[model samples]
Target chain A: MEILLAIVIGAAFGAVLDRIGASNPTVIGKMLNLTSLKLMKTILLAIGTGSILMFGGQMLGLVDVGHMSVKTAYVGVFIGGLLLGAGWAVAGFCPGTGLVAAASGRKDALFFIAGGLLGAAAYMASFPWVESTGALQGVLGGKVTIGAVPGSGYDGLFSALPGDIAGLVMGAAFVVIAFALPERLNPRGERLARAH
Target chain B: MTLSWKSGGVLLGVVFFLAVLLVKPIGVSTQFVIFDGILWNAVDSAVVTQTAEGVTSSNAYLAKSDGKYAKAVANPLNYSFVFVIAMMLGAAVSVWARGGLDRAERTMPALWRANFGDGAGKRYLAAFIGGFVVLYGARLAGGCTSGHMMSGMMQTSISGYIFALGAFAAAIPTAMMLYKEG
Candidate 1:
């Protein structure tokens, strides 16, 4: 029943992504631009609200801290990041956002999703070689989260910092960006609103 | 001026949250799973059954420690991944409702025209390459940009931090090249 509810919630979430133009790759892609900070407001708002909900839930014990997950460090990720970012710049889409784009009637988005699926399939088909190449054998480890460490670390440790601190930092960063950015530029998912 | 009924930003956040609360918290790398699932389904017929250690009766897969892998295949109705699928569906519905569901000609950057040849082929090709890169990175960094920049940061994962660093670093060059002055 809960999972079913989750699906409903998930569907609603997707609907929102479509309405806001988040599913549109270009709209979301600009967030990564250094000069643009195009996504700063959306980023800040998400981080801010996300922080509040997450911490509030955890603080109230409505959530379990232990169940959260992260991955082991690997060079594959580094290489992938470069490729993914480059792709975003070129094509203006990510997996999730791409899905939304396709949903929103962008045939171009459909192409991206299909392409990703094909690429993924191709990788899997070649996995035996990719794996045997030890291409991804950098540091094999179990699922680990930031809180798992006794001491703080990574991304200024502030970004990696969880709960209120991270929220405050991300939120503050957004606040600064909000002040720093122009209102005329429009927010990330509001592309259509900004367009005409 | 007018907000559409499809509101995507809050939904992005909402799905991001549901991801953690339900199935696998944080990252989902839809391309990876679909791609991997297809392969595993083909190869051992046991890959999909392969469950994470210490988990029992998970809706995704169950690890028995009995060496049989998990008991079930991942459902399309769970969180994160499902959220992504739902997102696609939502977008489809929204676009249809808005009457913006038709193909249109794009005439923006020269790069768009040169690469896509002012046709559907270039656009789709670009998308395909984009997906490939993202999944590869997700598999490599142990997460996607979403997992890293979005969920990873939220969860405070070291890998997420490291993954994000790579994403940002790479993003600099890519953005400069693509979005550079006309």
Candidate 2:
């Protein structure tokens, strides 16, 4: 039953990703380069809205706090994120988007998938040495939330502000920013047209 | 056939919210590791061994979490794995529904062509290298954009915010340096 549900959920997620142009590398590249802001706006809005719905659902008792998974805080996570960002700019596809692109019949995505699998293999092979380096060691209380929530196993960084409320406020901010962003920061096409 | 980005974004948000509220958060990077483990286990029977306790892997990473990953390796039909496969299928379905790839999609994107030219091989190589770097970093970070940035921020995890910061900090500059034409 759960597996069937997974397919439904995953398919919906992928379809939306494709509809929003995330399956296209040029769209991603444009977002990162500020040549186009459509994808970025969409992403910000999605994240903001999702955060609001999730935190709001939790507050309304429609969502289970236990189901909320908090990844451990570690130095490696931040460092690795930096590395991932560089790669994202270069390749213009994250794992999910890469898969979506491949399925969308973008041939380059196949190469990306192959590369990703090889990369995962490399990580598995070096897991021991990486672990020994202490980069993966938990930091900042291992798993924690920005603000405390009742029944959540994770600790809170700020006790005064409820985590759900914090999420809601931040989500709203994201939505506002998403709406405010211009469609294009570069407008190179328009500029070139004007020049001609 | 494509929805506007705004509508798509709302739909995506709703889907993500429902996934978390009803089941679990959406994640995809871990599956890459699982895929590797599965293939390795097939090649070398000793890579993963099932015992009375549970499935165990000779690989330390897979062996951690009480062999939870090893168990997934042995039984590859878990929710997460299936979800990833479904995502691919969904993407393919979307393309087919849209009447297949149009000329623009079949070739290089305008922005990419403006900066990098229309060499499919270059794009493929770049995509592959980029994917390699991203996945390698994801494993090191213990998550990807979906798991850590999107899901974590939704739940208000501090690590998620930190990861997002690091990602954007590097991504913006790299994009600037790489694509001046765009």
Candidate 3:
């Protein structure tokens, strides 16, 4: 039953990713380069809306706090994120988008998948060394949330503040920014001329 | 016919929210690791061993979490892995429903052509390299954009916020360096 639900849910998520132009590397490039903000805006709005809904539902008892999965805070997480961003800018696809694009029949996506497999293999091979570096060690109380939420076992950095409220506030900010952002930060024509 | 960005964004949000509410958060990168483990296990039976204790991998990374990853590698049909496969199918379905790839999808993007040439080989190489870097970094970071940033922020995880900041900090400058022509 759960596996069936996973299929249904995963398909919906993929379809949405495609419809949002995330399956297109060009669109991703535009978002990162500020050539076009359509994809970026869409991504932000989605994140913001999801955050609001999840946090709000938790507040209303429609979502389970225990179900919320929080990743550990570690130095390597931040550093790895930096590296991932650089790759995202270069390739115009993250792991999810890459898979979606491949399924969408973008030939390059296949290559991306191959690359990802090799990369994962490399990581698996070097896991011991990476672990020895202590980058995996937890930081900021390991799995702490920004604000405390009742019933969640994890501690909050701000114990007095409610996590749901904090999430809602942050989500709202993303929505506002998504709406306020211009279609393109710098005109493509202007950048082209400057390049020459 | 594609949905407008506004509608797409809202719908995407709803999908993610429903997943979190009904099941679990949406994540994809960890499956890549599991896939690698599966391939390695097939090549060398020793990579993953099924003992009375349960599935265990020679690889420490997979053996961690009490061999949760090793178990997934052995089983291979669990929710998370199946979800990723379904995602690919869903994307193919979307394309089929849309009457197949439009001109933009069929060809290199205009922005890409403006900066990089129309060489398919170059694009493929770059894509592969990029994929390699992103996946490697994701594993190092413990998650990808989906798991760490999107889902994490939704759950208000502090690590998520930090990851986002770190990602954009590196991404913005890198984009500027690579794509001066827009």
Candidate 4:
């Protein structure tokens, strides 16, 4: 039953990814290069709105804080993020969007997926050696939130600003930026138009 | 109406909210780890058992009761795996509906071609290397862009914000250096 629901949700999510031109490497590259803000605007709006719904629901006691899965802060995560960013810029696809791109029949995406799976497998295989290196150590295990809520198993980043208020402010800021950002067509698009 | 970036973003946000409301946070990186577990389980159940018990180098974190890896190993048809497969199905369906099937090809885009040249072998090699590095980093960090950045930021986790900052800090510079203006 849960799996079925997941499928439906995943399908909708995939469709949204595709519709936003996330399946196109050209679009992704342009966004990364700051040549266009279309994808960035969409991403900001999505994150902002999601933040409001989640934190807002928690504040109202309508959502169970226990249901949320929060990750720990660690030095490894920060460093890994740098590597992931580099990979994303070079490959033009993240893990999730790569799957969607492959599904959309992009052969390059299939290669990317293959590479990702192999990479994951390699990581697993080398787990023993890697774990011993202490690279994955130094974790701050407790949950950290921007504001406080009763029975929430997390710490607030700021004592003065409540989590809900902070979330609301950030969410609203993103929405405003999304609205203000103007989309520019990439040079590739202009070149294609000229050819046509 | 056809989906635009703005509307699509709104819809994605709503779907993400619904996902959190109905189940848990949405992420795709851990699904790969689960796949790794399944593969190990197939080759040698003992290795998986050892790994789960922290007897091996493989991380025991995912084998926790609430972990996605645990769910996947318990049942190959788990929620994360199904979600990923459905993502592909949804994309295929959308492409078919839009008559884009015929347009699908194994080729690099103009931007990539302009920068990296039009060699299929070289493109695939780059793709493969990039994919490997990204997944490796995601596993090491215990999350990917979706898991750490999107889902994390929504929940107001400081790590999420930091990860996003780090990602953009590296990604923007890398893109600027690699990007060739056409």
Q: For model 2 chain B, where is the 10-residue window of minimal lDDT?
A: B102-111
What residue pairs are clashing in model 4? A128-B57, A147-A163
Winning candidate number (DockQ): 2
Question: How close is chain B to the truth by TM-score, in each candidate?
Answer: 0.62, 0.93, 0.92, 0.84
Query: Docking category for candidate 2?
Result: medium
lDDT of 4 by residue, A96-127 (tens): 98888888877788788888888787776676
Calculate the i-RMS of every candidate, to one decimal place: 4.6, 1.4, 1.5, 1.9
lDDT of 1 by residue, A1-196 (tens): 6556546655665565555544544444445444334354555455445544654565666655454555555666667777677776766776767666665656676666666766665654555566676656644342444333223222223335444345435544544554565533424325534553
Q: Kindly list the per-residue Cα lDDT of model 2 for residues A59-129, writing each as its tens digit.
A: 89988988889999899899989988988888888989888888887777788889999988888889899
Which segments of candidate 3 are over 4 A away from where they belong? A189-196, B103-107
Give candidate 1 misplaced runs (Cα > 4 Å): A28-36, A126-196, B1-11, B21-26, B30-32, B35-81, B105-117, B180-182
True contacts kept of each: 0.53, 0.76, 0.77, 0.70
Ranking by TM-score: 2, 3, 4, 1
- Give the per-residue lDDT digits (tens) of candidate 4, residues B52-77: 54333234555444444655665778
User: Per-residue CA lDDT of candidate 1, range B1-182, in tens?
Assistant: 11332222344555666656655454546434544454466665645553455323321312323422222234434444455555567656666677664344222223355333567566677667777776655554546656676776666555665666777787667755554321
**How far out, in Å, is residue A21 in model 2?**
0.6
Candidate 4 C-alpha error for residue A148, in Å: 2.5
**Model 3 chain B: worst 10 consecutive residues (lDDT sum):** B102-111
Interface RMSD of 1: 4.6
